[model samples]
Target chain A: MTAVAAFAWSVLQDALHRKVFYAILAFSLLLMLLIPMLPSASVGVQVDLLREAALGLTSIMAFLLAVIMASTIIPGELGRRTLYNTLSRPVRRWQYYLGKFIGIMAVVAIALLVSLVVLLILVGAKFGTFNPGLAKAIFTIFLEAMVLASVAMLASVYLSPLVCILLAGLFYVACHVKGDFLYRAMTDSTNHALLRGLSGFLYYILPNLERMNINETIAHSERVFRVGAGELVLLSAIALVFSAIFIALGAYLFERRDL
Target chain B: MEAVLSVEELHKAYRTRLGGPRRQALSGLSFTVPRNSVVGLLGPNGAGKTTTLKCVMGLVRPDAGKVSLFGRDGDAVEARRRVGFLPEQPYFDLYLTPRKLLHYYGRLSGMGASSARSRISYLLNLVGMEDDADLTMDKFSKGMLQRIGLAQALLAEPELLILDEPSSGLDPLGKLEMRDVLKSLGTGGTTILLSSHQLSEIEEICDRVIIIHRGREVASGRLDELLEEKGDCEVLLAEPAPGATSGLPSSASWAEDSGGKRLTVSREELSAALTALIESGASIAEVRSRRLSLEEFFVRRIGKTGWEVEE
Candidate 1:
């Protein structure tokens, strides 16, 4: 096999040696259990509940997985001095970082898909309808999770794991309402062109969580889904570009560091 | 033998907790190890031996100067394929047995699945770990872990082998066995570079020695040549009369001996003393000059301050 393929396999195998897979299983069970315990007054409230629950489940699990995984990758390798062993191989420093990125992303994707499947089954049992749109929304959640994971990895590579976890968690929470923060600033009458441009800068910097979110639309049929294929494609490209840049930065810092 | 590994003017440093500038760990250190030779890197604690190895492996980039392997520049990925490093206190997953661990590392070295599978058993046997190959690495003792680590380093059949404190936690017999093993590996045309504080251990296996203290290489060369250059050697008397002890050279004063027959002495008076003793009625069963062990010779050169350098 090629070096890149071998590196990817190594990263995946190392990750599995930890109980990362088991923890994901436990969380999936929790999500399944929550399906029958919905506190809803009416059918509309119930579907809204399921939609919120499913989206929240996928989002929360993805967030936790990324934070947990990214928090450990660099620090654990350094702590064990395994980073030295791995880097001593013929693989490039960038390949080491990118392989880790891909491995963690693959695990997150699997967890997201599995959680979506379980939630869909519950939804099918309760309402006699399995919403394909929910499945689609879960896919977007995985995409957003990839963005969040990249951000987390970038922070972890530069800062202590604690600081990385806090910063990444804060961004994950704040980005969910990033659109509202920008809109509030944009509509304020007091703002001039310069302030508006700065606000716009901040807006574009934080991921537009609203664009990728198809959760609320699935619940309220009147809310038109405005996302186009072009937007999804663009957003994915943006996430990937950001991730690559972040990973490059990580590799550069790691290269300069004395294990 | 060509210099398979050369470190020139290397430097590194760490920042203190109290907002300070970089504190240099390595200070213009330089040396060369001939190919296919087992060289001992000797130093006390905090002597920068580990730092040197890390720099050579590119785990820690030097702030200044260069480290080269196989004529290529340091930190070059291409150079790494020919190198294998066993860090101090190597930790694999506690859950992985030697069988699994070797296979895992082989794959990382870019071997195919079938190849890795085939090489696993072979590497395990090479380390004398064939019996415990099926046991978890964590369950094995420190000596076993080190042996398995050796296997991993050798899995790629590297041209240059760098090991740091490889026998730090072995029993006397284990150490002896390990030295023999390393000697055998050296014979196979793999240049081995290792660091340790055990003077006897290094003396036993190394063809050459490099002594580093506080990040600077104080001495390095062929073992016998280093002793000669540094003014440390022993005088072995044949069957000199008991009264001859009083006639010993001042510099050649009696030193801590092995058996009653073995005695250490200074370099200057060794020839004259041996000639005079032979001329006398002392029946020369065996008369030979003894060089100081690598440890004592290293200590004599460094003056025993224990790796302290000012700036």
Candidate 2:
């Protein structure tokens, strides 16, 4: 456990040194602050509009950070031969793999927290009200990003970073649309057996990422669909189980491959 | 002597390209590194030295045979806890300072904070990087990185040390310092298995060498014994009479030396060459069996054709 923590700490320190990390955060915050100046934003419910735009910016920032870090950390270390020293120790390959996954999560969590704080300050100053309810949206974004990061990391062991990113993007779209699109494809009487079989397979295997997108629900002032604590707990359970499966599979494959 | 590490009939094959035929990297390779001795692993580029070390470190899985470390399987984490390895041209994250980097590795090696701190200090000073220990390694030269690599390898105070191309990027003075450090470590009872292309470095620091060619052990023994010529003798002559040229044996090869002219001949032709020199009234300066340098011995054993092919 100490070995895993040490590796995780190293990843945090290494990520802090990269300019891209700060660049993405700064760019997202800058864009968020500029949202109120838009001409169309003033015509509607201003506070709701501001909240929606800010949450959208924060989600994009968190997703980019999670996917990029998860995709590159392993392959970059392998390319630089830095892993030889780390893996040559008494530490097991599983520890290194798990530690890196946890590290990526930690970074994503920090980025989301910082973005949340900025959004809160902007809302308080613009609307003269402190709405703590925004935590629900931020938490769901975290859960969704965790799922994406795990998939990206699993792909990274066998594919390059660019390919991993592309695959993760495709997976996000497939998983989001599978709940609706694949259901129709699977049940339609006109569909061929092979096509139905493939859709069935994908629908059962891929995690439902769309369920975690509660941005609009929390952004609107009217609680049309309130995100209750029970829903959050169930979502957390699903995301944790799905991420654990990907991590375990990734670790198993990494252990067998020659470094 | 007890053996610290032993490899038996190890074999590994790597695919040249995806879905292509496998190329043999190690074929029935076997050797043992004795405890408390600095053993050199000498071979050309494609001779599988790195592959052998990787197998011992459990980085690469061998297709056949076994590696035992102090009576345990090489792949066991317990066995690896007592071993330290430095890869060829080691690289570290440039964002980390030497202190931070060693601390991270020390923690991975299971050292406590206080002990890891002390060990980091000792290793930094040992590798002559204590002055720049806190500076980020972004601008460090290759030699500086090599020093830090050595420091990290020693962070665990391992009983056995394996180094690949330890002197690959060092200057003359840095190489000398590295040799001195290694010699001190050998004296302090750390068994070392070194792989290098610098024959002189091996000749100076190693007591024994295992020479492998084409992934098989071609020679393994004490250094001096291996360099001794079996059936050759060298005869040196001082100033001689003008007619001495006519009396010299045709089978002898002549090469001029700073002291005088020297003739190299086989054991059977040594007596005839001496008698010819004596009859010609030339003074016999010295007579001894030909001594081959490590470089000369390596070329003779591996052949010039093999060397060119490796190049």
Candidate 3:
């Protein structure tokens, strides 16, 4: 556990020094600050639009931070030969993998929290109301980012960062669209048997990432339906299960990989 | 002697990119480092020295065979707890100061914060980086990084130290200091398995050497035993004598240096050569069996063909 924490701390320190990390964070913050510049709408609808846009920006920031950090940390360490020093110690490979993943999430969480605070302040000053409900959307964004990070990190074990990023992007798109496209393709009698079978397998296997996106609902003050505690717990469970599977598989592959 | 580390029948092959043929990195390589012994792992480029070290360190998985550390399975984290390693050209995140980096590694090695703090200070001084300990490593030279690498490897006060090219990238003075440090550690009973291309450094510090070629062991043993050339004797004169070779046998060859005149002859001709020297009025200083230098021994073992091919 000490080794794991140390590795996690090292990743945090490493990420703090990376220009890309700050670049992404700064860019997201800059966009959020510019939210007031959007064309003026009615007083009520304008605030909702601002909240929605701000939450969307926060999600993108959190996801980008998680995926980029996860995708680059391992390969960068390997390329720099720093893994030789760290892994040569009395630490297990799984501990290192878990620590790095946790570190990536920690960074993403910090980024999300900062965005949440900024969004709250912006809404309070601009519209005279603190929509603290935005926290729900940010929390879900974090959960979804956890899944994306795990997937990116798993691919990072065998693929370059560019390839890993591209693959994770494709995975994100597929998981979000699978609920509609895949379900239709699976039941369409016009499709071939093998294609339908694959679609069915994918539809069942891949988590419905779209379900995790409550940004619009929360941003609009949950006018349609409240995101209950039960739903949050279920979302947490799904995210945890998928992240565990990807991370476990990644650790297994990393164990047998040559440094 | 009890062995601190042992590898048996280790084999590793790396697949070429794009599904090309596999390149054998280690082929049934085997050796043991006895407790408190400093053994040099010497090999040419692509001779699997690094791969063998990585296998023992658990950084690389062997295709077949076993590595045991402290008489336990090498894969066990406990087995590596007593070991420290400095890989060739050790690297670290440049943003970390030496103190921070060592603290991090010290934690990884299971050292408490307070103990690690003191140990870090001691090591920074020992490696002559105390003044620069707080500075980020980005500005550090390769030699400085190597020093920090050694410091981290020693942070745990490990029973065994495995170093790959420990003196790599160091200036002449740095190399000498590193040699002295390693020599002291060896004398203090820290077992070390050092892999290096610097034969001179190995000769100066290692008590024994294991030379490998083409992923196989060519020769290995104590330095004196391996370098000893049987059936050969060298006689040294007390002073330079141009006339020393006047009555020497045709098989005897003599060279002059600041020390004196030195003659090398086959064991069969030693008596005749000494008699000739005595009759020629040469003052004898010493007479002993001739021993090859480490470089000569390595060349002989690895062969000229191996040399040309590596080049």
Q: What is candidate 3's CA lDDT for residue A108?
A: 90
Q: Per-residue lDDT for A1-259 in model 1, tens only?
A: 3555655666567667667666765675586567558566676678667767667767777877877787778887888877777777777777777777788888877777777777777777887876766755776777777777777887777577888889888877667666887667766778897877777776777777666666676544325665456766876886677667777777787666667
Q: How many clashing pairs per prediction, in order?
A: 2, 0, 0
TM-score sort, best first: 3, 2, 1
User: What DockQ number belongs to candidate 2?
Assistant: 0.80
| Runs of candidate 2 exceeding 4 Å displacement | A40-44, B234-289, B304-311
Which whole-number lDDT from 0 to 100 does residue B9 have in model 2?
A: 99
The total of clashing pairs for model 2 equals: 0
- Lowest lDDT block of 10, candidate 2 chain B: B302-311
Q: Any residue pairs clashing in model 2, and if so which?
A: none
> C-alpha displacement of B151 in model 3, angstroms?
0.3
Top-DockQ candidate index: 3
lDDT of 2 by residue, A147-166 (tens): 99999999999799999999
- By DockQ rank, best first, the candidates go 3, 2, 1
Where does candidate 3 chain A have its weakest 10-residue lDDT segment? A6-15
Candidate 1: what lDDT? 0.75
State residue A246's C-alpha deviation in candidate 3, in Å: 0.4
